[model samples]
Every structure is written in C-alpha cells, then in structure tokens.
Target: MEKTAFYTVKQIPPEETYPVRHPVLRTGLPLATCEFDGDDAPTTFHIGVYIEGKLAGVVTILENAHSRFDEERQFQLRGMAVLEEFQKQGLGQVLVREAEKEVERRGGYFMWMNARKVAVRFYEKLGYIIDGDEFIIETVGPHYVMCKKWK
Candidate 1:
C-alpha cells in the first residue's frame, strides 16, 4: 500500500509543507479565510500526500478566471481533502490527478470546483460535470459549480 507521490514547493519536505488549515478546503467559502493571491498565472496550487511518511492528503488550487465563468480562463479547484484515516485509500484520486497535471501544465483549459453537496458523488466519480443551480456558499454550506475539461 505504497503509491502516492506529488510535490512542488521544492519537491516538498519541510515537515511536508505543513500549513494545512482545510475545513473541507473551506467548503464553499464566505466566513473562512486563508486564500493566497499572487503568482499571476498560478491561480492556486498546493497538493500533499505522503503515505509511509504521513501527511495523508491535502489540496488547495484556486486558479480563478473571474472566480466563475467570465468568458475564457478558468481553473478553481478549491481545497480538496482526504485525511480521515486516509479514507478509502485512493488518496482523493491522487490529489485530483496531481491537480489535473498542474492544470494541464499551465496552459489552462478548464477545471472548476465548488462541490460540497455531500461531495457531489465524489466530483462525479472524478470526471466532474454538474454546473449552475444549488448555491448558498455564504457561510460555506451547500454548493455546486463543478466543471471539467483537460483538452
């Protein structure tokens, strides 16, 4: 049961880049805080998943293109998570395919997120789709605005 590798911040290490403050990755956000903004092109990126070494799993990607749709430019996969005894062992689909291969290697095509309606069937089985409807993220509760496309 050893298969989970993906690091960026200098190949990770410094206590596994411990800055985890994820409350369901801040669910939908409103009252929660801790959103870094800077890196012009880097909307957001932070994935950590160490098995034998610990750290379990963590995520934080927010590549906003106007937060949600504004005509071309999007990638807001907020704070995914997996630490409840490393649930199911899949490691949240390897931290979302390494954050969709770093959002398609930075070219950015499309990859949104805001699913919290009970995880929305685990992001539609890792293919994400649902869009619009079901809102109320003010206090970070119900949500839905999933999207996917890496081509």
Candidate 2:
C-alpha cells in the first residue's frame, strides 16, 4: 500500500463525487447518469479520497434497508469509484473502509451494495460477503448483493 501524505480521505459534497464517478463508474454514459436517488438526503454522505490533492476516488452512503438484513438501522453503499489510473493502489479499499466507519458512527448497524461481479472479490477482501445470486443491471452488467456490518 502507498501509505504516505499523498493520500487523504474526507467527507465531501455530493457534487464532488461526479468527477470521479463519471469516468470510473459510468465511463461511456452521460455524466448525468452518475446522479443517483437519495444522493442529497439529510442522512446521506459522500466521501472522497484524494491523491496529492487530486480526487482519486469517491463513495456515497445513505440510509436504506435491505430486506435480507434484519438490522433496523441500515445504510446502503453506493457509487463507489476509483479512477482507472489509480486502481490496485488500494484507494478503493480505503474509500470503503472510511465509509464503513462513518456509517457505524451514524448508528448504522449494517451496510450493503449491489457490487459489480468483476469487483466482487474486491469487496470480499474488505470483509463484505455475497448475499444473493448474481443479477444483471441493464447498462452496468452483472451484480451481486453484498453486505457488511460493524455494529
């Protein structure tokens, strides 16, 4: 891991996530495609990982429940993105870990996401588990529900 002053993770406004999300998560789609529901909700928060002062990754967490999870206070992890040039340098893992801490701090008992099939192993490395069968998301390809909890 590149553990140096070059990296910083902090809370940011939803708009700040677009720059990273558009390319990393929605490359061929319009930038507006990156916008998601509940993005500006009172309980939603966005986190950005910067490399030498440039945004290198982003993630969003919002209050939502998954029927499979019995936990009353649940948060959904969404729009996680790491620029292609920065992949494998551990930024994606850092983004998710920070989001996990923030959610637990806010009283969330668990969190989940529709993880892309290609990234399933990545989330598993961070202690997230596949919760269901894989399904296709129209323009996004295959995905599997994954969940994790720290409370």
Best by lDDT: 2
For residues 1-151, could you state the per-residue lDDT of candidate 2 as single tens digits?
2246769888999989999999888989998998999999999999989888888999999999888889888899999999988888988888888888888788776889999999999999999999989999999899999998774
In model 1, the number of clashes is: 1
lDDT of each: 0.64, 0.89
Estimated TM-score for each candidate = 0.29, 0.94
> What is candidate 1's lDDT per residue for 72-106, written digit by digit as tens?
76777766666666678777787787777877887
Model 2 vs. true fold: TM: 0.94
TM-score of 1: 0.29
lDDT value, candidate 2, whole model? 0.89
